[model samples]
Target: MLNGLKTLFNKKSVDSKFGIALRSQAGSYALDKGEDTDIQAGEYFTETSESAGDWLDDLLSSHNFQGSGHLVLSASHYYNVQINKPDLPDNEIPSAIKWLVKDIVPIDPDEMIADYYDSPVIVSGTQKINVVCSHLTSLKKYTDSFKRYQVDLEGIITDEFAFANLLSHRKHSTLIICQQPFEEVFLIIVKEGQIYFSRRLRGFSDVGGYSTEQLSKGICDSLSLEVQKSMDYFERILKQTPVSEIKVLLPVKHENFIIENLDKNTNAQVSKLDLPSPFEQMRNCAASVGGLIEFERKGAEND
Candidate 1:
């Protein structure tokens, strides 16, 4: 009953001619006007919980985001410590991280520079929070790294925001699977283009390092868990409307089989997400390329 209404509303929204919302990720960029694109860029420098800043700086200096458009550096490994059932007042929310860092995270919170924002909590009436933490030197290193590549860095945005931006057209509940070559799988739930939830699952890989048989089984099993979690989240917490569709975007090679297997695992229609064009289609430039499109779009709107 409610699902029908939501579908009708989504259809109406599409029919109303609202502009397409655009989005970019670590490896892909997509919009409503046309096809989506993938980018092929060289390795992105990454560091674990306690790495030195030089490694990250070296990574940033190798690429370019200037003139490409609006680009966001969505560093995924940040310590996103969050508490749901907060007993504090609304304004006091800022201190939540300070308290968390002191007791929760492994590294010294003071040694890391952190920024936080409040998100509208769709489920519980509790306040929702997002925190981004990185070493202060690491921030400078990232900036210096871009300078090394001679790519003009426009601005930085968190990955979650970028993920939400791409799915803006979804009025009915939707599930998005974001796969990077060696990183964990990211699952995002979109309702009417609003992000209801996001989570990252570790130990997932798509690189050719694994044996063919292992890779096949791994892809299917990982996707299976992703589908299950998406369903569980929709039913147990969201309870707004069931996910009407699931879109899988795998940037690695031989992902077709994985995508095909995903369709068989879930009732929600599954399909590979397409790229917009040369920007996305360019060789080995997925993440950087998508970042460029988004950067350009935001610049145009502001102008």
Candidate 2:
């Protein structure tokens, strides 16, 4: 009976004006509505529910959601890894990835759901493939939650890929460091729309409270070391040219601190991420905003 609900709720239809970007922070959920690239509304929920039907009822009644659209998920729920491209047929890639990642993934292979993104570039006859894995139980839980509300989940994407989609227009190699509220930070390197490297670092708040100056200094030192390592690997291992600039996505309150500190320490030109007009006041929700941008781009290509 529940399986029927799950299957029924998983339908994804591309023709729509609205999209939803859903992400979990701490114990709550953040949902945003996007009409094309413009954000129309956003709401946060704190209540936790074990019953999907009850949860959906509450969400629908409270938000007054009117139409079905794409649902973009958060990266925290899945494991994203990069592995050497395997020599195999396209149809057999999924099985091969399962076997390769069995020991490394935290969950059992039998209970895992896997997906992959192929790299746009082939270097030295080798390619990099991004693999995303999630536990079947968690997948079912979230799917069932939305299924009860009859929300069509267009696709599941990581925050990294969403950010990559957000910056697809750039022509040169660049590094992106995104720091969200709470204690989450991601470092990503991209060139020509392909991700070469990515890492999530421990934030200053994760360790303990600190003065503004101390926190700024800590982030600067940590970013400098990681940025240097990524640059070295890009040149030495990937044999690619160095990145021309580093773009940091941070809260407006700490933007100056990161920019000033990173500028003094790194050779690359450091700057803040440019947000679209709709997102000018809500820099903190970049992941969700990026997901909306990505969905619109993909939907247009298909049209």
The list of candidate 1 runs beyond 4 A from truth reads 1-76, 85-96, 146-152, 163-168, 206-212, 215-219, 280-284, 300-303
Residue 222, candidate 1: alpha-carbon lDDT: 68
Report the C-alpha lDDT of model 2 over 6-32, residue by residue, as the tens digit: 343656543433334444442122334
**lDDT for each residue of candidate 1 in 1-303, tens digit (9 for 90 to 100):** 001111111111110001111112223322222223323334333344344344544434333222222334444535565655356675664545555655665557666655565543546766656665655454454445445545444455545555555443666877877755555567878775456777876656444355557656665776677678768877787556677788766666656667677787787888766544443443233444445445555556878
lDDT of each: 0.51, 0.64
Worst 10 residues of 1 by lDDT: 11-20
The best candidate by TM-score is 2
Clashing residue pairs found in predicted model 2: none
Model 2 regions lying over 4 Å from their true place:
1-38, 41-61, 66-75, 120-125, 203-210
